[model samples]
Target: MSWNRRSLDRPTRRIALAGALFCGLTSAGCIVIDDAEARDEAEEVREDLRDAADDIAESITDALEEIGEHMSDFAEELGGETLVDQPIHFREFYDFLPERAGNLRRTSREGATGGALGFHMSVAEAEYEGRSGAEVEVSIADIGAMPVIGSEGFVEWLDLSVDEESDRGWARTIEYEGYPAMEEFRRTRGDRGRAEFTWFVESRFVVVLDARDVTIDELHELRDAIDTDALADLRDREGR
Candidate 1:
């Protein structure tokens, strides 16, 4: 009978030791010992963790959204889209050309489209006075849709080195009615000659006047004849 009592006491002591060990591991005032209460506390902890994760995700999303908005605003301020996407009306530019440049008379006028190349051009032919069969061609090209040509770097590229001895001929920078311009004059041989005046209007459209058998003075006069203020007004209307 004493042996049976000792065996029962040993089993009861082992069970009590296991319960104490579980309580020590949990350290929650032994409340984890109750199955239902422990399940409720675990669910509450899971809910709090989920809420914290959701808040973190929301914060990240908001930050990204704000960054995107700022980038869009910056692009707009640079006139990147407005300058590149606006359609070029060739007629408006054609009208800006004068009926005559000095003694030269306009012989022909034509409009050309570049299609997929994204450009519009107006060409005018003029005959030099007192010079039989001698002609000059003046062309205005709108290359705003082209990224490289319309960019700020284009202005730098126009700053060509002026050297009469070089094959490229004489290239120089000059101001045309307050706008930066490039003038190039080249003579291949004999009396035959070529001259050009190129400039960017409103930092968008590219205007070029190419003349055959025309003097530098005549080209300058032609460049000055263009109505720059009218061109500015046209660009403003389109941007709006």
Candidate 2:
């Protein structure tokens, strides 16, 4: 009878030990799996952030590139000594074009990317010699609302696009007539052009970039800017 009892106790002890060991291993495995999952999630989030930053950087670079390219092409057509600069500003936003490349005319003081009222720094010749076909025009200003009403209006007024490749959300015509002052009106207005910069938005306002070599009426036919649909789409997707 004693032997039987001992035998039964031994089997019970073994069963208890086996169950405890199994439960402990399962718990440890669960903890390991949880830790691994957390690490993977963190890695994914970091990668996403990096990708977003990269896309933004790329988009900004592309916009600047387009500006530079257009300026270069226009300068080449003028056939004169040209100077270019990246950093330029008026009382409002960053002046995208620092100076008129070939003619060194009045700089367009359009609004900034963040919605601000822009002022024309100076009024001068509309087109450089030999560069008759080049002029930057703003056609739309659809920036969101802001605290200052003037800023919003200015943003809408100065959102000019000369590069056809950037003609996705805005209208920018490049082939506008920049006139030389005719003798018929010399007595009244001296030497000035009838150039116009068409605003293609809800509120149509012609913000004249210069009143010297161009006329407001002649600038009505400025509609040659090309639409860079693919480039613009890529930029939009990148969130620029």
Query: Considering every candidate listed, which one attains the maximal lDDT?
Result: 1
Q: How does residue 177 of candidate 2 score in lDDT?
A: 30
Cα-based TM-score, every candidate? 0.51, 0.24
What overall lDDT, based on C-alpha atoms, would model 2 receive against the true structure? Answer: 0.28
**lDDT of each residue in 3-108, candidate 2, tens digit only:** 2113222322333243333344334433332477786876666566556545544443343343334434433444332111111222222222233333333322
How good is model 1 by TM-score?
Answer: 0.51
List, residue by residue over 42-102, the lDDT tens digit for candidate 1.
7676566556545544443343233334334433444333354544655556687778776
lDDT of each: 0.50, 0.28
In candidate 2, where is summed lDDT lowest over 10 consecutive residues? 179-188
Q: After superposition, how far is residue 208 of candidate 1 from its true place, in Å?
A: 1.1
Reference-based lDDT, residue 37, model 1 = 78
Top model number, TM-score: 1
Off by over 4 Å in 1: 1-84, 117-133, 149-152, 155-169, 187-192
Report how far off residue 124 is in candidate 1 (Å). Answer: 7.9
